[model samples]
Target chain A: MTGRVIVITSGKGGVGKTTTSANIGTALAKNGASVVLIDTDIGLRNLDLLLGLENRIVYTLVDVVEERCKLKQALVKDKKNPNLCLLAAAQTRDKSAVDADQLKTICEQLQEDFDFVLVDCPAGIEEGFKTAISGASEAIVVTTPEMSAVRDADRIIGLLEAKEEIKSYRLLVNRVRPNLVQTNDMMSVDDVVEILSCDLIGIIPEDTGIITSTNRGEPIVNDENSPAGKAYINVAKRINGEEVPFLDINEPKGFDAFLAKVKTFFGIKG
Target chain B: MELNKRFIVDLSQAKTPADIVFEVSNILENPEAANRKIWLKLGDVSLNQSQILSIKSLISSINSTLSLIESECSQTELAAATLGINTKDVEEELQAELSTLEAESPKDTPSEQYIPLVDYKEEEPKESEHEQQENKEILDENKQQQEEIENKQDEQTTQNTEEQPAVSSDINQEENKKDEEIQNQLDSIFDSEVKLENILADDKDITEMQNWPLTKEAEDDFEIPEEIMTDEDYAILQMNTQYHKQTVRSGQVIQSNGNVVIIGDCHPGCEIHAAGDITVWGVLGGIAHAGCKGNTKAKIRALTLNAIQLRIADSYARRPDHIKNIYVEKSNTFTPEEARFVNGSIVILKVNDR
Candidate 1:
């Protein structure tokens, strides 16, 4: 039941890192495992907002490590779940606020009580990124199916693989539009997996719910009704050691489509 | 000198040595990972030193004996998510339902509760005295914003349920409106709790993690026989391990993906491979490969060239020569900066001409 610190990062920015952190943190919490999501973005912190826990923050990672507050004091409780917590980054500070060594020590402290420590890494492979990744036991490299993102993810993967800290790495392809992949217009999940060459963690479909949920500051996993939410829940369960089959978010032209053809008698879409 | 090694574990094909259940970075740092691969067995636990030393505290944490047990038990499931090195791990339907309950209770998470069993207290004090102070300086600025975000969300949920009596209907309405947000809290579980589930538990399964096997640390102690390479101890034994490529020329590839060696500059757009080391005698704009087989210690030496990029042991550093110098700076006109890793990043050092 010891905690694990995992950094969610992609070398390139805007691939939904904060969103992934919020959902994954929420997902793990949903699995009944205590989790703490650390926002390492520092100056550009946003994990608290994404998880909708902006107000509960009493102390932050900065305060805890600086001795301004205790480690437990910095942990912001998740509104939806008591097991989940958020260790917010310092908005006024920069990457220099923390180093890899400090983050590792803090994560070691957090690991005392939490089962999982998911670090929401800032964009770029600079000090901030290095600081964010320093403490994790492993890394979750988040990237989209796009080449640029994938390439940058590859660089990060290379960096992760380079250090003795990360023996191996895994990939999480965010914002995948299965439609484009099926049409051969974009890289398929296999293609992305083939390149990065690590364990494939999970595939999230291009769901508007992810964005709208982010804007609303609620984790998609909280919304049991959305497909993406279900996917995240599945991700959490997987994290917990359950072997769940992959859900094909591919455009379904199944029995429902056939039934719809029969309903064409009543007139649906042309 | 022996060079370093690095690898990306394909959990799908992840394999391990006979003696281990999980091969974390700490384990890699362990004396054993070099000569043998790392794997895990059911009901086995081996995690020590992965967290305290390297930046891979996460790996040490993820590859814990506890997570290994969870994966063996199949309590939680995995789902496909993320952009890199991640696999599709969907949970059993029952676990998915259980996952709902898990979402509600955060602090009491099973993983967090197990820390003491893993000997958490021992690792903290020694490190806290040394590492904690530095991190405090970094997170101070963003802390407030993060705290507010967390508080508001907690209040929001309270307000959501308190103001709206019908929870299910409101959830449904919210779900439909935010239909695109299939991204959920479960994703963090995959990164944190579930990643360990994918750790290769056996040797044969090592490839399941990735296609390549480059140890991040040099796997030494090969027990070199005294008879093999001691030509008077000059020891130039011809083992298949060392690859030697042809000479590099303009548009000249000593070997496609092979190591090309030259003493001068490489012509622009020329591809050269020198599995061992590339010694450029003259200035040439081109590509040079050094220690392609997961060896970061390999050196790339050159006089001068306009080559825009250089690949070394799975990393590429771009030359700022992309923009021609319009004029010399006021400091002093000098040659372009040499490539070096300064402050942990690869950058060109604009050295003054001698």
Candidate 2:
């Protein structure tokens, strides 16, 4: 069976689009589903590094688009998870090297063997954004609580709605500081949903474990104790169409701490 | 046509394009009117390409329709006029054909009718004594009903558009039936002579057709205003400064070519670019670029200059690492500062230092 091609995009830069793509793809693959993450950023390649497959990348997305290598050859299998793989981007070349039609053909080929194909899009609404989203049927817009990221995400949603290929979309607010949101200093999750007007798939709070994992070139989903890691695992469960209630970001930590330990015992986080 | 159904403009008496436009505008301004279609009886009048286009644009602006009737001119020439082409070049091509047309038509009729030299003298009235009195009474009653129907119809049309905008074709069909019913009732009342008149001032009604010089002067009168491309600067230098009182949120960009003063904070990820000096009375947390037009002399002043980036003309600076430490170590020690270009580099200094 063919997989669903999903594009993860945010119009503004410095938001966690690559981080979200890496975590979500890993979370899906950890559940015994075959998943492939395509890094389409071209000149600014980071998704492979986030998944700790940077040095192992011998064939890139541009190589596949140029017919220099077969699509299967370009895909590098994750060392830890056999069901998860990554197609790295070319750091030397720019986005103009790959057109929208070429990417569409590559995605169609990749979807046949994978259960979930997540395309990590670039930052802006320029050529790179168009090339990354041209093949996807579903979109997940990542936005921070800041006004700049939210406004840019709104602009991206408008562009996605205009495209006939995109059938549906949902929002994921990354890098949320629960303490700041609770004290009224920062924008809350409800405030973001009111403005964006989209189904919120998940909310990943600010955690020091995310930075520690990214620096070490390891996916945070491997750490069961981390709250950010648990959030990603839950997001994967929700994506499977299991009516999973969201993590109570504002609720007292008594139940969440107990449940996170229960999940650790069950070996849900890999 | 029914007398009360359509407005009439007998082009036989109109001498110039300007005179026809003037008459039509007058009739359209009246509140009580029947149909928007103006029946132009071109029995003895001839129009060039420019005159037809000018009349068409005028009627279109008032949301009215024009239907032409030809009696003297050949059907081919009438069709060519209504085709809406700029035929100044082709007018010279048709000069020979028009000369033959002039040879066959009435001798007293002028060959050219577009000259700006017009005579504004009154002509004899067309209404008969008995018909004029009967038309006046019927017109008064018809106008009252017209006003009432127009007000009710305006509200109904707005409601229809708001409720079922997708069914506009159905609304058009219903309106056409209502118009036919109204026309039949008016036709039975004024069955004789209730013609729409000149609808013009007495002076404009009698503009002499013979006063026009029938030469290259017609082209001079038809210099289309739309073709002129000269750019005119109508801006007045009234205010050299702008003040905004509301907070500028993230991703919002505010720019000006003059000095700007803001009473609220500029949040992160937002940008403000100005050509002149910028003064922020509140916290400045975003990117502020002054001297946008390469005016290095411009300065940016803020009560709390906590911006991510600052640029004055060609020089630029980002928030230094030490500044972040200052916020953490001794946040209360921070003071109001203004940034300016000093020797091709942007430097922030305390406001009291200046």
Candidate 3:
């Protein structure tokens, strides 16, 4: 079966593009789908580190593309999930070493063996960004609730819209502080959605578990207790065409809480 | 010709067609100047179509009997004498003046106006004057400084023309080098996989996979027309009120050339634009643009209308600052509301029980 190639990209740096990619890929793999996570950041590679496969990386994407090693030899199988694999980026090579067409060829080959190929894109609207998203049929733009991140996400959306290969893209609002959003200190999900005018695939609340998991080279989606983990699992379900309503992150007050409870009890589905 | 003083009314120095007519009419108005030989110097300036027609009529009225010099060279006595035009009186004065000025200045004579219909540099002198004023202050000491600035500009313009070809060729070389590097990079990366993929695909049952839009090339060949008229399209166009039962999620868009009715709420970032009325059974936190096809009579109705913006035809209304505060305070249960185009603006009113 030809797998769907998806790319996770954020135009701005430090907005959890790599983290979202790892988590979503892991979540998809946990559901018994054979998934390949390709780190396309090249010189600034971090997907391997995030997957805890950094020590196991003997050959990387550069080696596979350059024909120094076979595609199967380069794929590092995950210890956590047997179906999940990591194709690490070469820290020695720059973005230009692998062009878009090359990446497309690699992804096309990967799609034949795996059920899904998720690419972790680099930051900025540069050559690396182009190479990362070249072969993807679907895109998940990760953005924070900050105005700068939202604005950059808009630009990334505009770029994605220009691509002929990318059929559709959904926004993943990451690191959202529900408290700040309610207090109006930060932009709410509604504000972000209004500005970007894109479908909200998932809202991942701010969780310190993500950082701890990243430090241990384990994805946050492994833990079933964390809100961020549940959100990601929900995102994966949504990606797999499940109809799941968004969870209420903020504590609804008084009449609002009663209204919300009624809506939930009835499964209003709006 | 009973000559007193030969008044050369320079048409080239005139700012416009009206200026030329005015200058010539002023000289002609004097009874003494009228009787004298009014030498009309066409100079190097060419008149446009409209200006030529206006000036021709103006000149005809100024002097019925006038001697015309076809070229700027004919304005001189030596050139006029050679052409067999009488210049015996002006000939001696022109020779002495030309010799003395010839040493200090190379002939600053105006060039030939071969294409009189195209030349429109009559306002050039005025433009130059404006440029000079901008370069330096008009203070007593800066008059000479202004002239020097103007002279420097003339030198720079000439230098720019001479160096332009060299600069352009350098840029072209740099661009070509960049293109070659990119070509080399692409050749190195894609040279192997592309050939292997082609061979592998050839080995497969071509006819069995032929129907599928599998390859990127095949997908590209599959074109969807900008406007597709399906059974749904036809039905939507014919219906007065098209009903949609699904909630329009963020990033989703629903458009209709006819009236639309959404049975669910419109979330933020969801947009519903229609040519006619739009009615929502639930809340509308999104944007609803009714009368999108310029039908001003269209209206929008919803159970809860706290949308970010509402548009009817050419007019629109954003959620006001006060409305946001009100929404924050009382957002639990919204009263059913209707929005319409009234007095060139979108007006929303609460719907009472009827």
lDDT of 1 by residue, B265-352 (tens): 4554455554444556555355554545534434455555344345545544433322232121223322433332222223232233
TM-score of every model versus the real structure: 0.42, 0.41, 0.42
The true-versus-predicted C-alpha distance at residue B66 of model 3, in Å, is 99
Candidate 1: deviation at residue A131, Å? 1.2
Candidate 1 residue B331 Cα shift, in angstroms, is 53
The RMSD of every model to the true structure, in order and in angstroms, is: 33.6, 31.3, 26.4
lDDT tens readout by residue for model 3, A96-162? 8899999999999999999999999999999999999999999999999998999899999999999
Scored by lDDT, model 2 comes in at: 0.65
Candidate 1 error regions (>4 Å): A253-270, B1-354
Top-DockQ candidate index: 3
The 10-residue segment with the lowest total lDDT in model 1 chain B: B190-199
- Single out the weakest 10-residue window by summed lDDT for candidate 1 chain A: A51-60
Docking category for candidate 2?
incorrect
Between which residue pairs do clashes occur in model 3?
A198-B251
